[model samples]
Target: MIEIALGALITLCLLLTGTCLWLLTNQREHARWQVERDARDALRDQRIKELSKRLDAYLTGSVRMGEELQELRRIVAPLPDKLNQMEQRDPSSLSFTQAARLVGMGASVEDLTQSCGLTQAEAELVSKLHQAQRRKS
Candidate 1:
């Protein structure tokens, strides 16, 4: 009877030891997994912040471009009227080519051509007129 009781006690001790070791290993693994998950979440948050900053910069640039475009339009708005007045006063005396030349000396040829409907020959004439006028001035 004494030997039998001692063997049962030894077996119970071994089972308890195995259970404790298993529990400790499982706890360590759980901690490692949690650490990995936290790191991934932090990296994702940082990426989101970077993207948000870039989007803000893009929006700011778009707004600045819009303002610059509006300002350019405002600066050029009076030119057509001035050109028309000049033409009205000297229709027979000034040719389209001469007008185009004058416009080219100070303004964009594309803008002048579109506004005044001047042909390429007229644009060249206008450029020549502008040179002559500058010389006189």
Candidate 2:
């Protein structure tokens, strides 16, 4: 009876030790998995913040471009009327404008002087100006 009691006690102790070891290993694995999950989440959050900043920059640039375009529109709105007023104010200047157009069409200085009634110096100046304009274009 004494030997049987001792054997049962030893068997119970071994079972308890095995259970404790298994529980400890499982807990360690759980901790490691939790740490990895947290790291992934942190990396994901950082990436999201970077993307948000880029989006904000794009939005700001778009708004600024829109404002600049609006300003350009306002400045150009009265240009046609102003040009007509200048043409009406000086009817003879129309001859010079036509002379420049002819020069752009590859006309010679003598042609401008004859067709547009420009002086030789005026025709030469118009030809030079249109040639310079063409080169710049």
Candidate 3:
């Protein structure tokens, strides 16, 4: 009976030691897993913050681009009217070819200047040059 009791006490101690080791190992694994999960969560949150900042920057750029485009449109709005006015001024000055023809017909320099809107010196030059050409021909 004494030998049997001693054997039972040793067996119980071995079982208790095994259980304690298993619980300790399980607790360490749980701690490691918790740390990894926290790291992953922190990384995900950081990425989300960066993405939000980028989106805000893109939105701001889009709004600025839209405003610049509107300003450009406003600045250019009167260009067509100004172009039409310039086009309509065609009747102000007679064509250079017409002035040359008139010079060939013996029109005076003053007449060429007034009718063709040429400067006095330009009219004189054209008259002299064309008269010389006519004499040669």
Root-mean-square deviation per candidate: 10.5, 5.0, 11.9
Error (Å) of candidate 2 at residue 63 is 1.6
Q: What does candidate 2 score on TM?
A: 0.59
The regions of model 1 sitting more than 4 angstroms off are 1-5, 93-137
Instruction: Looking at model 3, report the run of 10 residues with the lowest lDDT sum.
Output: 87-96
How many angstroms is residue 5 displaced in model 3 relative to the true structure, after the best TM-score fit?
5.3
Superposed by TM-score, candidate 1 places the C-alpha of residue 89 at a distance from the truth, in angstroms, of 3.4
Write one digit per residue (lDDT tens) for candidate 2, span 1-137: 99999999999999999999999999999999999999999999999999999999999999999999999999999998997788688665456777887887889988887787888999999999998988999
Q: How should the candidates be ordered by lDDT, best one leading?
A: 3, 2, 1
Can you give the TM-score per candidate against the true fold?
0.55, 0.59, 0.55
**Which scores greater on TM-score, model 1 or model 2?**
2
CA shift of 135, model 2, Å: 16
Tens-digit per-residue lDDT, 9-126, candidate 3: 9999999999999999999999999999999999999999999999999999999999999999999999988876765679777766678989988789999988899999999989
Best prediction by TM-score: 2
Give the C-alpha miss distance for residue 67 in model 1, angstroms.
1.9
Q: How accurate is candidate 1 locally (lDDT)?
A: 0.79
Q: Which residue pairs come into collision in candidate 2?
A: none
